[model samples]
Target: MTLLLDSEEGARAWIGEAFAPTARQWQQLDRFGAMLVAENARQNLISASTIPTLWVRHIADSAQLLSFDRDNEGLWIDLGSGPGLPGLVVAILCDRPMLLVESRKRRCDFLRAVVAEFDLRHVEVAEAPLERIETRPASTISARAFAPLDKLIGLSTRFSNESTRWLLPKGRNAVKELALLPEAWQRMFHVEQSRTDAESWILVGVGQIGAKQRGK
Candidate 1:
C-alpha cells in the first residue's frame, strides 16, 4: 500500500483530484469539520489525538466511500453512525438520500442538528439501533467500527437486497475480519486499501448477504 495522506493539504489535494467538490460543497464540509471539532470536546465523537488531522483521518476517510458508489442509486444506510462519518459527509458533498442509524440519543441529536444546520433534505436520521429500525431495502450500506464482520453482516443483512453495496471501513482489521466470515460471505466481499492510512482497509461488497450461514 502507498503512504497515507498525512497532511491537510495533501488530503485537500486528493479530495479535489478525486471528487472535485463544488464551492458550496466545500463550504459545507468546512463548516461541518468545525462543528465536529467543537462537538468532540463535549462527546467522544472522534479521537482527540486525531484532531490535528481531522481532514485526513475523518473527513477524507469518510468521503472516500463515495467513490465506491458513484451511481448513487437509492437510500444509503449508515449503521452506527456515531458522528456521521461518511453518511453526513456524503450528504454534504452530494445529494444522495441517506439514513444515519445511531442508537444513542445524544449522537442522534447531533446528527439531526447537522442535517438541519445544512438543510440536507436528502438525509434522514434513525434514532435507533439496527435491530429496532424498520426493515427496508438499501442501495448502499456502510459501517465504520460498528461490529465484527460476522455480526455486522448478520445484523445488516435484513436491509440489503441483491444489489446493495456494502462499504465498511474496518481499519487495519479489514482482512482479518473478512477472513473470519463463512466461505460464501468471504467471497461476497473484498478489501480495498484505505487512502488515508497504509495499514487501514475498507471492505467492499456487492449483492445481498445471507444471515443463516454466518457463525463461528
Candidate 2:
C-alpha cells in the first residue's frame, strides 16, 4: 500500500508532538492502526483501498475530534466503530472513559486486540450492535463516516442527553443534510472544512435534545 503518512515510531512522535499536545499516546494509536490492517486482510472493516491513506484518512481524521472538547471528561462513545476511529484516538489522547460500539464479531475482535496491545486502560470495546448496548448519557458521541446525519441522530437517540455533544465527521453532503434536518430539533451546530479532504466537513453540535424516542 502507498504510505500517505508515516507508520513508524517517527510517525508516533510526530502525532504526539504536533496534535496531541497534552498526551503522548501515539504508541497506542499506532498499534491500533496495525491491528486494523491486520484484521482487515481477513474481512472488510474499513475499505482496503484506503489502507494507503491510513495516516491522514484514519489517524488524523480521528485526532481532529480532539479539537472539539480538549478538556472533555465523562464517557465518550463511537457508534459503528468499524475500525475504531475517534474512539480509540480519543482514548489515547484524553483521560475520559471511551467505548467502541461495533456489532461485527471480527471487527470487535480486532478492536479488543488493539486495546490489549496498546494497554488502553480507559477504552472498552462492546461487541454488540448499537441498539443493544447500554450507555449512560455521554458527554460526547462521535460518529465517523457511519451513517447519514438524520439516520445517525435517530440511531443514537438513546445515548444522547441534555449534556451530550455530537461530533460527526461528514463529507461533501453535510450542508445538504443539515438543510434537511427537522426544524423542531432545536440545536446549533457548526460546519468546518476537513483538514484531510476539501470536500469533507466536520459537524459539531451541543445542546439539549428533545425527549428520547426509539431509534431505528
Candidate 3:
C-alpha cells in the first residue's frame, strides 16, 4: 500500500476501495458526518476549519485503521475516544464488537446518542477514564491524540496480553514518541506512515506490556 494519500480526492477514493462499506454502512457514515457537523455547532467536537475536508480528514483518517486490522480480531477498544473518531467510525463500517472509553459527560452523551441513532448493538460506550474502567482482554486497542506513549501504556497495560495489537496514531510525533519509550517498548512498536497525511505516522505494535526486558 502507498504510505501517503496526498489529496482529499485520493484519500476518499482509497477509503472507498479499501474498506468498501455497504450501502447501509455508507448511510450510517453520511448521517454520522452530518450529525458531527451539527453537534460541532453545539459544542467543540471538532475544529470548524476542517469541516470542508471532513470526509478525508476525519472519516477517511479513521477508516484507515481498518487496514491494519485485517483479522477483525476479538474486542476492539478505543481509549479516550472523544467524538468517537475511529471508534464510532469503525463500528459503523464493521461488525466488530467495540467499546469506546471517554471520560467527559457531554462527549459520552453524544457517543451514546450516535449509538442509539445507529442502533449499534455491538458497540458500548464507557463513560469513564481508562483507569476507572474494568479490565478485559482487548484484541485491539487504539488511541488517537490520547496520552503520551509511556503514560498510555502505563494506564492500559492491564487490558493487554501477548497477542494484543496497539494502533496509535501519533501524527508527526510518532517517531519522537516511540523514541521516548523504554528500550523494550521501543522494540515492540514500529512506526508506519499514515495514509491520510504524508507528514503523519502511526505507531503499531503487538505484545504484552513489560514482557520484554530492557536489555534483552
The most accurate candidate by TM-score is 1
lDDT of 2 by residue, 112-202 (tens): 8777877788988998877788757888889996788887887786787767788888788888888777764524577877666777888
Best by lDDT: 1
Estimate TM-scores for all models: 0.95, 0.84, 0.94
Question: Regarding lDDT, does 1 or 2 come out ahead?
Answer: 1
Which of 2 and 3 is ahead in TM-score?
A: 3
| lDDT tens per residue, model 3, 1-216 | 655665677766787888888888889998999999999999899999999889878988888887898785699999999999899998888888999999999999999999999999999999988889999999999998689888898888889888998999999989998987788888879888887788889899998775445334
- Predictions in order: lDDT: 0.89, 0.75, 0.88
Q: lDDT by residue for model 1 over 62-176, one digit each (tens)?
A: 9899988898679999999999998999888778789999999999999999999989999999998789999999999999878888888888998998899999999888898
Ranking of models by TM-score:
1, 3, 2
**Which sections of candidate 3 miss by over 4 Å?**
1-3, 6-8, 211-216
